[model samples]
Target: MARLFTGVVIYSFFVFLIMTPLKAKPSDKSKTKQNKYGIALIIGNKNYKDGVPPVDYAHNDAAAFKRYVIDILKFRERNIIYLRDATKANLDSALGTHNNVEGEVQSFVREGKSDVIIYYSGHGVPGVKSKRGLLLPTDATSNNAELVGYPIDQLYKNLSKIGAKSVTVFLEACFSGGSEGGMLIKNASPVFTRIEAPKSNLGITILSATSKAQLASWDNNAKHGMFTNYLLQGLYGAADQGEEGNKDGKVSLLEIKEWLNEEMTYNVKRQHKRRQIATVIGEENLILASVSPGRQFKPIQAFEKKKTVARAQRGAYQTPTISPSARASLNIHESYKSYGILPIKLKGKRCVPCENILIASLEGLPDAKILRGANARKADVVVSSFLSRLNVTQEANDAYASAKVMSGMFGAVLGKNIVDHIDRSTPPSFNIFDVELMLTAKDKNLGVSETARGIYFDRKDARQPKQSNTVKGINSVFRQAAERLAVRLMGGTPPPIKSAAQIRKQWEDKDQNAQNGNWSEDNND
Candidate 1:
């Protein structure tokens, strides 16, 4: 009886360990559900008085951003403060009490007592402090302009006083360098602000559009200021891609940067030529949570389970048992054993392009204009280049034309948006490893894809051949194939060449609609 009891006890212990994983542990469950709330302040300033402002297209950015946060992003409208025309009165009203901007922010935090404020989408201009960053306002003046622009430090200070726990800011503009990973001035001394939650130990995260020395692009493109649109998509589901441990249906701040940097850049390049970098700072407890961990669990399974089948399939594709002499001669595969093509089928086009077209249409309005001399090369060249890659054959001209017609008809009403369209799918059927190589060959290529991230090329190398060589060499054969493909493309001997120029034109045009909120949602419905 004693021996039997011992065995039973051991079995029970194993069961308990297994059950613990299936059951929600203490750390698994969220602390509070009622306290859950998010606050967003989206600002876009386009009006300016003076010489060659590089921000003409930003006029409607703020307004478009407001809708994204409230309607598309699903932030509670009441909790959001959107400012399009940043006149002094509007700025003060939006930021002050009894108004939608800062004042309302205070009220929301005070009332719901929840933490997490998101500020995204805006332009930053050079300030008097030499390195000081300024968020431009509608009625801003060049002389005392720095005074009118929204100061990021003030935002941190104000939110601190409100006792908020965490703040994540996403700014899509030039000169976003000063906002994160730097010392925040308190009266004068520099101090770390994000590392510590301003009030009640709250954490903060700031993601800027580009580095201090770099510039961000703005226009009517549905891409909607590279950084912000990608940030938005990351929040929805992109961050969670390939994620297996999403306990609360959420993604962490880190995960978001990883996924957005790759996914969004790819999406943006399909329209704009430029690639924007999103810099993240600080930390947070919960950024994104998983909705279905078990259903999507595939960590070890992806490799262990798939490898065997993959190898078996490889046997069939093995070089046709070439002659013994040929086998002994030379081969690229043996030297680069780990290197291979990552076969992907770039899907999800139905609503995506439609949305982009509508957004680009917004620029057609008198208020809209693309950012001038402010990283235009990045958007124009890289984005246009990718669009030329689409397999939209001349035979599909009717399909492409039909899609455009549908976009124009619906765009007149629905406007461009980033609403959830479809389940994410594989990338285009082309082997990405090969695509990277071909891109590298083009004197105007974005650059070699480093881990398939960024806008198909490095922003600095964009439109410049010297920069293309900077692309890191990873998969040699794939790269060579892609280079060959690029040569074929530029040579204009490939199929699906209905007017390669037209394809590029459409892509550029679509980007304009996406940022401007002119993408269509319905087809004559």
Candidate 2:
């Protein structure tokens, strides 16, 4: 008995020793480096001037990133500069004047011994004249961004003067002069803003939410910018654990970008029915953060669960109500697979262009198919619309006209908008259109029907009195109405329809190229 017990104890001890990891317990993968010589400038600008739409959840985004910087990245709270709804003066005070790059940030740097991080969640506009990408400060206007806006190149130049060992920049704004659901600049003749992409210098690395011509999205459920939400998720260890990552614990700059590329592409496509690709410049092996409890990352599963909820929200699309007359047609799925979009009736008149725009809006439903101008009997579903109201009012843009106002009578008397052509201090005005419509969807095979009412507005710059934006505005209304009806009948809400300017640009391109250009959506990217 004594020999048996001693042999069992010796064998168990040997097995335990062999099974243990040789590297280190409480493994280094869960450990992050202490960045003592790093300084961060985090700014979230949401409430801009009245004309500009607020960047919803920008403050939340900034707050979350600031927390990660201090807690996860091991940055000291004292080394961080946090700003919300920052103004031009605030920018100048923190990063120094454009003329001389010397501010609180400059004072913190240790002359080639520090790493600098800059993150901005706000609006970015391009110079109407220079076409330079400019950060739209709270006190700035997109139409006159060149003067009041902070230049991106100037920002890089100022940071370069600090002489940090390396600088990393994260921009949660797009410079396309288009807001999440509207236009930022009111331009005459539906001109393309053509804002250039935000760029960085050799020593500076930049990760922007959207490329030029793309609009950044808001994740209303997360209460954060879609880009910023995933950004924090990556910093929270998901990036270190992704398949592209080595799972060695440290999350590198390259690893996070790779993770963002895959996740952002997939989520934006599924959620918004649009393409929003994060633009990354410069590939460095610099470690951004580290995972904890080494290789025990659970964020992947959590986020996947959230995605599944989104998928469920976009539930199996079926007719909301069915008639008793067609008993056999009441079955779902097979009965309403395609909808024939009839020409929308505008104030009791047929408008083919309005129908075309409405048809374009439903083009994104992945499960259901759209049949343009198909007969009601031929299609499984019949879609139609009636425009109830189309109203327009001309008004001055407060952001631009507040500087100095000239009577529209001057242009009215001169037979043209002389103020616009003369480049006078008296700014040009805009046209605001309010459109209301009732959209109807009839599941023909199911003998069911549903109706949705939608009201949308479009603002167009009236710089040239000769050019009328009525057609574009009406088209925009029909499109928005279609989006609303699509959600009511098809379960998932689509992205905001294109602005009047974008629709006009398409028409102009079609005319100029004689339909041979084959304009593609990716061109805007």
Candidate 3:
């Protein structure tokens, strides 16, 4: 699948309403409807300690998310644990200590009876010593993070052991040192930190605010985090809107990821003018929310380790994996009928071969016609790809500072020329200009769109690969990126590129099957 950056929702009296659901009377302690089965731990930390940056409108974001939880997802209000500007003690009580997981937020799960939702909108800072990501509490200063701040990894661990049927976490805080909310760390500057997909337990999914090289942005006009607002909007029926969505009235995990990357990314690009994509972990194709009121999630057999797997299989292009029977409850998007490949550009220079390489890469993209020449303008969707130079020297140097923070003597070692002096360092040397691929697909005629981007050093380790800073290396990156983007643009998972010999073998097998009269239904030959 294409690596995407994006997620969000919004509601108001005058806002556009998609579909109104008939609410059921609440039997629980609170006045919320008895629809969704879950407990939610919502923390919107806005006011930070003195000198720390406040997450502007974070309290508003949490409040809005709560509204959706009740009004849309229909979770009873009594089951929710809401905290505004939560303190270190509050977070510890709610999420448990790093050493032991006894917090009500995780322990509140009723085994098979309740799913879990965790939403946090605050400042996340990296540990000065360990360099791990931490959610700074209102009372916790960025410098003393390891002592008072909440470890994001531990948060995952706590949530994973909840024994709930599923755990869905929505985080509006950016862990890479900055946010529209405020500067999280005291003297720390923002550096690109690739947030890894947590090793979540079965049925756990996490949708967070920003990609590796982005800061969490806010909608000043909306007085909400842009991610939080858009996510609310999506859950409120924008995700399941018309053809972009399945229109099934239920928003699935896949639908949410897709919708956010498309709608939120475009909106951010249009509004913030900087990249901020939502990153998701886990592939459980579960329904996240619904337009229909009081709809319940049907019981699926308990999540067994032996039963779950993720595959980018669609139509006839099934990946080489387990079996055909494994792919049930498939959330398939619409197959593109026609597409146009606009000229591929690198630093504003046209690269004809790059476009040709991309066109050739799309050979396995099923059920799509490539619009040719002038007719390309008439394509159902037009694809545009651009590659640009990215300088990471400053970011690299900041990482060295983080290295210094990790250990005092070690910090002294990674001094002014630390970016160059470190041997096998976590922060890579800034010898070469990194590349960023911005891939956009727009169906302007149909008011549909998607944006996906990948950076050369966009990884947790930030290790330099054998691919060097040369034309060949750039082309290599472009080829793979182009394929991934094209597949995603066409609404399919990127399949392994078929070799020329593999293609020949396929034809030879077809010929043999025809001669022997051994045609199979699946072959469709």
Candidate 4:
């Protein structure tokens, strides 16, 4: 399937109000509904005893996210929790205690009985040097140099106990070098992880505000964490407005990343005159809650099934065929139709090919179910064996010459016309394999002719049988990136475009203007 890069809803509002039960009336289902509550926990710890004040913003960020959740997202006040550096009693009532935040989280989840999202903004230090990631709540203190924060494991365990299916966590803090050395943790930067939810098909998604080595900046203009500011912007409609799959009201994790990249890059530059990096980790297909005003179900089954089949077939190098019994068992239509992973023949081998490769790669990394096939069973293994034999005589000769390796992969799958303007006929050193495309005036009408040229793999030499593996790895990356591009561009049906005649007229006008030097000059004077 096309890799999605947009989330579906505003983080402040995780649930859409639909069919609320009567206030006084009571029914058996009402009990279940009461338990099915959605909760958002936002904390900004801006004050610290000995630590840096700028390192924490737990109060401001939490307040903003709370307002968004309630006012904008329409969540009830009782359903959400906001915490600052409150007393132990208030902390216990709101979240949990110093030693048992996990228990509180679990109990809240179980009692609430629904999806929960936790947002933490504060100073994050490596937890004892061995843990994956940790979230420091507002009450965190580091008196003895040993880092103390809410252990992520306990949070996961509590979420599991509560029978919640989906939980999203956002961490905006620095984790690289703490004043006091301790366990190295992964949560210092932006990170996302999806874990199995209890009693349901729900999952957890984690979004970190920065990379492990990068710092989450403060915005004097926004008076909020740079990452959080851009994040909120990405949420609450800016991203959804520009995204394709947002039609369903839910934004996928991939869409969120793309929107964040675009928004943060510009917003941060203008706001702080610097660039910040955020990392998104988790299930690619994980659905963020809907932001649409009404209850609208945009079932992804049709789209998901098609991409799954395509990915499976692409890996196996064979046509995907589902038996009637298996389809029935899986509760899927026997004759399923998908708009992704169109069937194609490569090297006389029947296989499914994604419309985009980068998306395929991103999706493939998370899904262990997709397996490699027999077509790549044999190849040379030497590091330079297969590469030395392939015909890579041309240097950066295609539209992808300037693109990042991942982007180049997308260009390859999109048939190249999307980026034909990039000319890479010559290059000094091609750090990564790139394809160059040359277009004729007549061919320009057909769009870009996408091609891949490079010695990605070779088995001609007896020493290296892993040649096929190298090629497969590279192709896999390309395929995944391509899928991401497709998801971004085709999330929704595209607008209609002009006919060839219109295109010719437009082209002719531009050509005539160019010949006469009729375009406006940069210097107005």
Candidate 5:
């Protein structure tokens, strides 16, 4: 009886053990918890069979963006669908409901809430009939835009139907195909048509590279589109605008927009000699992504180190030796320390606001002591500024006028076909703005001068009156120029300015080497 009872107890224990489940240990992939479920569709259509010029670095831009979203944003790789040189059919199938992105995203949303991000880097054509924005695929052509082009409004509507928590669209393509560098499309009318967002209750944000009439610029140095590069920079935490004490790890939509507006405008003006304003429409406080711990913002070592060394050297107060002849003309033995800023002189009709900006900028310098409303004799140096109106150079105006006459005559005498060819061959007029800063000794004998001039080709059909944003942009330019001049006057070397191309080249080479394991991701990530 005892042996039988022991056998029954052992049998019962074995059954219990067999029926029980054990908890599985989480792996590295599982350990990475996602705070918000997100899905991304990235498309870069570079190869175009038609007359449309191919976007040289579209594919590279897409790949880099993919790496950014996955590595830095902590997005699951499986949730991302990447397409390069995609055709119309591929886009249609992917976006359609037949076991495609729409269905997948919808299913994901139904299971759990998710955010959708749609990014496109390609050519965009303005719709003729409905004035809808159209994204050109690899198989699309200027003539067949209506048929092959992906309607941007349709895309918004489709994504909105998925019931995702939010939808963000990034269009790096330009409808005008006109860049600050030059025109991409030959002989196309420079009519600016705005891209309006579709009416949707779902939170939808659209960030466009340029306004309706502007060209989306490509930076050969960075090997990415200019807008996309800045976008990536923002994603990497360059957009963080929070105070140090209250530093949150997330980048807000407002921060990104502000960063893009300032950086893009500055870069386009500097590199392309054109004006490009990034457009953003959405809720400002939307959190795009939390900054990764490994990718926290770090100041550029080259710039920061140079500034530090300059400041230290300036603090030492070493006097610069002047030649006897120079001293005789200058009537100064020691360096000028305190400076007084005079109201900037306006040389042109439309530069009153520029004067105010220049004065404000001069006062903002750190090392300089600005003596306000003080007599010139009380200060060591007096700073004067002259701002000129934007003007078309004589050479540019002549060329444009000649082209217009020739094209008009050719269209009337020969044929409409010949007119387009002639018009395309003629370059547009260039607009230039000149700003000069003169620093003189209190005695008015010795002086040093600096100038900042900007040349741009206006792509807008008609110039609009200066708005607040325009005024602010102009102020920023003057401020930067003033800051550099102040540094020079104080016996300190201004930080070296890297060209957009040089910086982009370095970034591209670094990314390339990293892929080959010659560099570590720790540097950037």
Candidate 6:
């Protein structure tokens, strides 16, 4: 079955499974009625005539996307305008006034106030003269962007002119061509300039594959662009976070962004050994799509089933649940007499303090028998730790602080603070850390390996008045993480790790305090 569906064929099967309606069940007709006039434009340019290299999977990506928006999102097939290997003239006829297609799209949008989605997968070049982002057509040349390239700003303006109730844009191409899949142009600069959106009431949202300076990756195994593959998964219901406490099959833009961030960060790190930060700019709560009840997409079920079978075959060596007395009688403690702690590998900035705290906590554990230097290498077991921080930026911190101040001043002048009111409801840019610890036997004769993983949030920095004890607060959090990891290694069950919502709530509380100027010296230890 796996061999029968590989590459593009497998993705088609996935789309079919997701689109097929269940038997004897009512369709989501009621919900579809509200968005009956939704429209989409999907363009995939793979065959470039100029010196620019061709994208291997752009056409296939466009095909899969068309199926998803039509089958899962319930968009009318007649309303979707799809183009493959689009040339400059073809794009002008479709998007501009050269042909009847553009006029038809505008009329439909204006008459019905439709929801609009525009997706492009191809080579993207940064404007050398205009300093804007450009999406290239199949016949476009890189040197003459002004004449041939489709300016992103123009794209936004054109979509806004359609007067749709909401517009969503997905650009699966990167401005800076540094992809690992050998899909970049020759002599492209590493500097990235962000594509700007128009400030309008059209409720526009944009999801870019990567930042200006980063490379958008291609996943050969999945035979799709890394960003688009995960995005389809989210739209197919893998990102449904049950916003109303029940998985009623609705997926919001916010949930999709979360899933993309988590999956892309891990995948890019493993595959490219570099970072690819996806950018999401828009109203987060906007509804992208919804699925029928009990309908979900699982792309890698066959691989997962194979893994389960392999694990079942190793049942004889599986770890057993033993009481304290039984563990002592079996001399389990003697088996792991001396444990060595390696110098932790840090993946992000400002993580030295957390590393120190973890080392200290492990050393302080009574009867843990941790060793250092030469003696540590001859120990029975060795432990190593990895720490990664995501979404930590100076821009985010500046925006948070500026919003708080502006909200307070506006409230004093207008008798009601509009900025403050909005800030109270908006989510804060909390710094998230992914922490993992692994233990392995030094001799390899013992065949022992144990692992623990968790995510931690640093929220105290946002709510504190003076930010004097920020390092102390972070250290405290690290200590708690270390203790939990130790307990798990010692065969004890700690409480479950906090969910994404719970971590978000911690930042939300701090944001409220910062907005109210009611900061306390309390630590989140």
Best by TM-score: 2
Pick out the ten consecutive residues of candidate 4 with the lowest summed lDDT: 379-388
lDDT per residue as tens, model 6, 184-302: 44455554657675675646799888875878888766767788888887777777743321345677878878878888766977887878778888887777787655444433211
| Candidate 5 backbone collisions, by pair | 178-215
Per-prediction TM-score to the true structure, in the order listed: 0.40, 0.50, 0.49, 0.41, 0.48, 0.49
Stretches of model 6 off by over 4 angstroms after superposition? 1-35, 97-104, 179-191, 200-202, 241-248, 297-525
Model 3 lDDT tens row, 351-405? 8766665554443333345665677668776777766555433234223433333
Name model 5 segments beyond 4 Å from true. Answer: 1-32, 97-112, 177-188, 241-246, 294-525
Deviation of model 2 at 343, angstroms: 67
How accurate locally is residue 147 in candidate 1, as Cα lDDT from 0 to 100?
A: 61
Worst ten in a row by lDDT for model 6: 304-313
Per-residue lDDT, model 2, residue 432, is: 63
lDDT of each: 0.40, 0.64, 0.62, 0.43, 0.58, 0.59
- After superposition on all C-alphas, the RMSD of every candidate to the true structure, in Å, is 23.6, 30.2, 30.1, 26.3, 31.5, 27.7
2 versus 6: better TM-score goes to = 2
Tens digits of per-residue lDDT, candidate 5, 322-386, equal 34544454232243355666654434344545444444334323223455454644665666554
Q: List the residue pairs that clash in candidate 6.
A: none
| Model 6 lDDT on a 0 to 1 scale | 0.59
**Native-structure RMSD, model 5:** 31.5
